[model samples]
Target: MKRVIYGLFNRLRFKHKLFLSYLLVIFIPIMVLGVYSYKQSEQMLNMQAIQGIEKNVDTISESIDGSVERYNHTIQSIVYNKTFQKIVTNDYLDLVNLSYDLKEYLTPYLNMMVMLDKEIDQVTFYTQTYVPEYGDSVLSAARVENEQWYKDAMNKTGSQWFFEDGLFVVSKFPRFFADKATNLVYMRVNDDSLFKNVTDLAKDYSVAIADEQGRVIYSNQSASKNTLDADALIRMNEGALMVGGAESFLVKKAVRQTGWTIYCIVPAVQVSPNVGSIINATLIIIGACMLGVLIIIWIFSKTMIRRIYSLNVWMKRVEIGDLRMRIRSDSKDEIGELTNRFGTMLIRLNELIDELYRNKIVQKEAEFKALQWQMNPHFLYNTLSFINWKALKSEAYDISHIVTTLSKFYRTGLNRGDNIIPVRDELEHIKSYIEIIQIMKDYSFDVTYEIDEAVFDYTTINFILQPLAENAIKHGINRKTTGRGMLRIKAKLGDRTVEFTVEDNGEGMPPETAKTIMQNQCSGYGLKNVNERLQLRFGSDYSIAVESIAGSCTLMKIIIPQNIQS
Candidate 1:
């Protein structure tokens, strides 16, 4: 049998295998847990119902005890009252005096007792002395002498409760008056006030207050012939009972003030009425969980199989030499990751093939451009030197000086095609260009160089300063009208950086022009080119900044790192 089952499982597809595994791992366990939970819940609900019945019995007992204590205290108060003793024991001379004594002392005292306690229905005084009937509050003892409760109270020493038609307490008063005139204080309470708590319980529940003799004094349930035996309930104390041939839950609580027991009986079926519903709900939940498991397994298997098949097709294309195929998946699962990796591999393979051939072509072009660039700078320098020599031979000394300065400027600007040069060489290049400008303009503008000697040790991008000086003379110094055009070049050294400032006393450009001068095409390539080269070589931290005041002065500052390698 095991072999047969294994063979059948092995023959199934992956999705079928996964579905079977889910049933074994998830569905069966859920069903078992559902059954176990139902059994536990039923037991717990039964225990809770029993506890609730017990609690109700205790509450009824406490309420009855409180009423009994209150009645006993009231009876004691009446028995010990001096005015009540005087009114009952006084020898009346005539009917008028009797009426006056009753009205002035006895009637008001009884009325006060009843008014003070809302629970006390009426207080009646019964006396055997020849006192005419004075309403129900002063009743004659001759009327109740034949009553069993009256006989019992007279026989007893203290207060006694009698549950006849209604609940009442009887007590003999004026113990000091030993004359054999029967005197008793009778207090009656409304029956509803004693049994109010029990009436709020469920109809199926029966509550009974049983005296010490085990007779039912009060019961919320109607007195039927087949009522539960209160004697058996008191003796049994608690647990199961039989009511009308049906098993019931019984709870008993003792009223301490009165030697009575409160009995609460609940039908067993009422204790856990929702047991069937719990079983049905558990079965429904198990069915839902099993159905959900099957659906999830199916969806998961279908999605995984589809993605794997797609990935296989892509791999097949790559195997057949097609590297341009593209695929994308937004899922973050393992299969999606594998698919993405495969697509990336194909793309990188294509890029490497193109980059290999393109790099070779770029290498040859760069070599040719390097050769061309090398020839042009040297040829221009040689031509400039030749012009200077000719001007010297013609005794044109100023022309020769201008030509020599221009040659020196171009030589320092090229720097053998290297972008980085010492600070001294950069200064020399800009100085040579400025000398050429001064001679051409006939020394119109005064030039000052306040260069710190320590800055010559650092390195900077070549040809950066020459263009700024040229812009200063052409745009700034030449436009000055009120004062002599002064051009100042200052270099300062700091802890980790070097700063160069180019200032001019020419008619300075507008604030807006200075702000956008580097970005504007009409501003020419000198400042913009220098800014770009400095930024590209040393990042934005070592770029040029322009600050100008219209009609006053224009200042261009260049900052560069001091520790740069030459």
Candidate 2:
């Protein structure tokens, strides 16, 4: 099965693979976190409901205890009063005497007790010596003794509660007055008034007051058939309560003044309302967010993977040597940068291909041109050498030197039909041409050379220097009035270029004529062709400049890039 799944995965396309990867990386964790968050939210809601129930039960217990305390305090006052003790224990002379004592002591005391606690409906005393007549706030001993509460009160030591037909709080008289009065003080408290505040405090839930045996004494709602496990409810105090197989939150706080437990019962449905709403809302929000994220991933992956596809196609074209293919994208992300780089590479590759083709054609043309000049210069050198040998045999030494210099000049100028020659060889050609020119005249300009030895090894186009020297001699020095002038030839190396200057201290042309000569606007074929050839071999960066002052001096400066020919 695993191999089958792996085989299916291996066959998937790149786009599908990316989409599946995004689904796993993005959505899986979100789903896990969504489920975890819902559970935590439910637990938190249940905890808050339990806390709320405990708080309500505590509030009810405090109210009931406070009311019971007030009643007990009134009973304490009656038990300690000397006048009440005398009314119970002293022998009365007759009915008139008893009425006088009752009006004076019991009447005022009972009225004050009633004023102290509004929940007390009536106050009655039971004893062996005194039998109080039934009245508004009093009860007869014979009428209460027939009841079970009266017998229960007789056996008790301290304060006790009886909530059978009405809420009664009974307490024995103080031990200091025990011998004089075997009496029990009881208050028939108003049960509805006692529990009204407790019922209001827990209006959201059904609250029940229960005895130690878990009998339901009072409840704010109608009793249901749901029987509570009394011992379990007590043992699980402030915990869960099971009612008819359903779980509920119960807060059973014991009222310390009474043996009663205030039970606040909250059904499971009520406890889960907030949790249900939160889960529903959270699921809706998570579903929407997941949908939005998936949509964004789809668009993003589509855009990115589309670029990769285009790149792959263009690469395949390039693999086939088709450099014209281009991928264009406007996005500034990494993929866009990749597309731009690919396009740039193709463009540069095309340019290089065209340049190589043009260079091949130029090399062929140069070879043809060199072939045309090869025989002419060699034939001219041989003829000039023969003439020099004849001139030397006839004892014409000066004429022989002229022919020798001429031969050397033509030989070096052709440079074995090579376009680039060493700077020293070009300088030697210049000197030979200068010597021949001097021999042609009776008096010639003195030529001096200032050439750096390091630049002698650098190469430039053959015959570049000879033409400039000839230009200075023919145009400026030869036209001088005195016919005797100075020609200075200088060559030097700069950081990236070589410079040669031929300056003549002879008749100079006007600045406009000099500009026109440099601009190829004048009748100067040697200078024009020299400039054109240097530009054609190297690029437009190599050039010639003419600086001249009328009738004073003319300087021709040629600058070319210095390089060693391989």
Best by TM-score: 1
Q: Candidate 2 — which residues are off by over 4 angstroms?
A: 1-35, 91-97, 130-142, 177-181, 222-247, 274-276, 280-566
Cα deviation at 469, candidate 1, in Å, is: 70
Error of 2 at 477 (Å): 99
500-554: candidate 1 lDDT, tens digit per residue: 9999988888988888888854443477767766765567677789998888889
- The weakest ten consecutive residues by lDDT in model 1 span 363-372
What overall lDDT goes with each candidate model? 0.79, 0.77
Pick by lDDT: which candidate is best? 1
The local distance difference test score of model 2 is 0.77
lDDT of 2 by residue, 473-496 (tens): 888888888757899999998878
Error of model 2, residue 351, in angstroms? 76
